[model samples]
Target: MNFSVGPPGLIIAAPRSGAGKTTVTLGLLRALRRQGGAVQPFKCGPDYIDPAFHEIAAGRPSFNLDSWAMGEELIATLATEASAGATISIAEGVMGLFDGAAARGRSGTGATADLAALLGWPVVLVLDVAGQTETAAAVALGCARYRDDVDIAGVILNRVASQRHFSLVAPAFDRINMRIFGAILREDRLALPERHLGLVQAGEIPAIDQRLDALADIIAAAIDLDAIGQSARPAKAAIAIREAHSDGARSRLQPPGQRIALAQDRAFSFMYPHVLRQWRHAGAEIVPFSPLADDPPDATADAVWLPGGYPELHAGALASAHSFREGLQKLARRSIPIHGECGGHMVLGRGLEDADGNRHEMTGLLGLETSFAKRRLHLGYRRARLRIACALGAKGTEVLGHEFHYASTVSTSDDPLVDCWDAAGAEVPEQGARQGSTTGTFFHVIDRIAI
Candidate 1:
């Protein structure tokens, strides 16, 4: 029932991708934090990477605000909950404002614009003014006129060449009447590295604080933080927020003590925080253990969970983690339910080959071999139907989740992790995989649905 009432605001974004949305967002977050602002940052959509930088900037755990996956009530609830103790909130938008759950001709629904319209937040367009000058104004103008739903507050020009470039671009915005927020200097320090999953899981980045601080300073010098803070409007009436435990009514019949040991480390970090919270609310005590730390679960837990992350990066360490491997084996021998997600799915395989084509041993629970050698990116918003019993549910259970990874399984058998479908209703081969009481897959279960 906790509520947040303060100088909360949002960042409406994206004229396009690679337009420096992430950099600008990170810079603003860091700069605001540096200025002694309790900035609660939220990433629109189901992205895990951007939230990492948000956390770094806000000095708090950043949460995802997916308009597509979650209902409006949930969005308001999450935003209000996250904003409780902060001076202001910054919601970094995803993709282009209009770009949504799917490409132009698709059926999926989540998008930056969709979120903006739902939350009633102002848009601060981060336009890439690299090649075009006044035409960039036309682009911004078109975005403004394209949808009456978005409130295009201002513009931030990225990759500016010189004062000369702004000299030209600023005039164009003047012609279109879009206020120019600020221009980020085209510096290498402001950029973060990217890979198949997104910006190399923030944990993988060395000297993360220094990187964040540098980006913050760069942005602070450019942006007027006061104006940005002023851009935040008062949230809707207090009744708008849903309770954190609002979804508990659906799980009144589930039993308690079905304990689960979750894998948490650089290799298995794709878990949704809300999901864990809801599981606990639903009578499951989730025990967290680390594969990277070479630790095993205490023998008392009834189930094991390995969420997704960069297992490919630490295949060597994970393969050599005798305590964890033996512990999983022992737990499986005792008929304890074991489940794995993307990176977890890979870890349960017989072997895992890194990006370099070198193979390493894994837990071998699923008798599958996975590799990033071929590196076919399987990214999508997935909907799955359980065809058989597993740790979280039984056959015929439907769940909404996401798939984001670059590794693929080299399977000799047709046994899949789970029987599922995508948002498009196409049969997804392995919603997840199972061996005895152990199961793993690339699906990211949405916490809201379970709640």
Candidate 2:
């Protein structure tokens, strides 16, 4: 559908992290939504946390506009399409505006500034004016002038110490020919809750709206909401895509099963939004049960899928779910297809040992045991070649995915999960070992091919 609203204004960020970009972005989204403006939210990189807050603010699933992963044209197209009904679109910056993937090179991940220039959207710079006053203006001036292609829309001073600080820094924006969007007081509650997997996946937090409301109220009261809304400029052109992957053309149908129960709760929430959307589009009915609540797979389900999440945190609850255990055991006895991802892999194992060396009984579908205490950071991009047939794909099939975990398997079979290839084409060991109808791993599949 063609969007009717004009192009939205995007936020151009700093050259570093911890600059309060996320807070300012979230505040604006909530404030706009409260003001009755149709606002669509977009993030500039591959982040799961911020998008959760964005979805809360916009009341719709917000998509990522990654310059590196998805390309600039696609980013522009997503912005244009998303902006169709909203009065203004807000694309939050990543680490920093001018910071690219590398220190200096063409191969570095696309930076926030690169995306701003590509979309022809004006940037409202959010500067942390903590210790210095006029120097803050110099930083804003430098970011604005560093690249002529990017237009500096306005300046929003964050973490201002006092009224004197605002008075000291407000003129710096005028001298540099930049508009002052608004200033925000330092607030602690506005800080979003976070865990290892990123801002505590939205599904994990039930009171997310309360947090968004607090942020919106603060931003609406302190910042000039109307002027900031006006600061958004029409994107010169829609986000475009030059090269498109052929995953949509090659459809992989999810095999039919009477009852497909998905493990969903705080412990199993790291699912790709598109995957579920596509599954429903492909005529698959999904039933959800909670491991955190000690609920097992419904007896009617013929297949069970456990996505990744913080299984280590709820070790006690998961270990004690009697109904969940008995229900899963019943499914296993019936030869059901059971698949697990990072956290799911741990739960299906023989046992889970917490950081304090406490072991908890799990589903024991596979002869694997995971430990968070004996952990090592495993972060990387992966390409996999499946050796056996499963519910999601066929044998000898290829899939692209990523791995982000800090858990190790204490007792596992020698057989590997699937053959993995790194970005450099070097082969790593198998991601996880599989036996029978159950499959699992530490890797999070990107699903280049539709599943």
Best by lDDT: 1
Write one digit per residue (lDDT tens) for candidate 2, span 1-451: 2322255666647656788888888888888888788887877765667877788887766766554444333344566755677777888888778764433212124578877776777888888888978998899888878889888887888899889889998887778777887888777886767766567676656787887788889888887888877777767644342333433325333433546799888778777654565466556778999977878787888788898888899889998888887888788788888888888888888899998999999888788988988778876556677777775577777766567888887888635657787554568754676767777877766444344
Weakest 10 consecutive residues of candidate 2 by summed lDDT: 100-109
Model 1 stretches with alpha carbons more than 4 Å out: 1-7, 103-108, 243-259, 280-286, 412-417, 448-451
How much lDDT does each candidate structure score? 0.75, 0.73
Q: Write the per-residue lDDT of candidate 1 for residues 179-198, one digit (tens) a residue.
A: 88888768987778898778
Our model 2 lands, by Cα RMSD against the true structure, at 4.2
My TM-score estimates for the predictions, one after another, are 0.90, 0.82
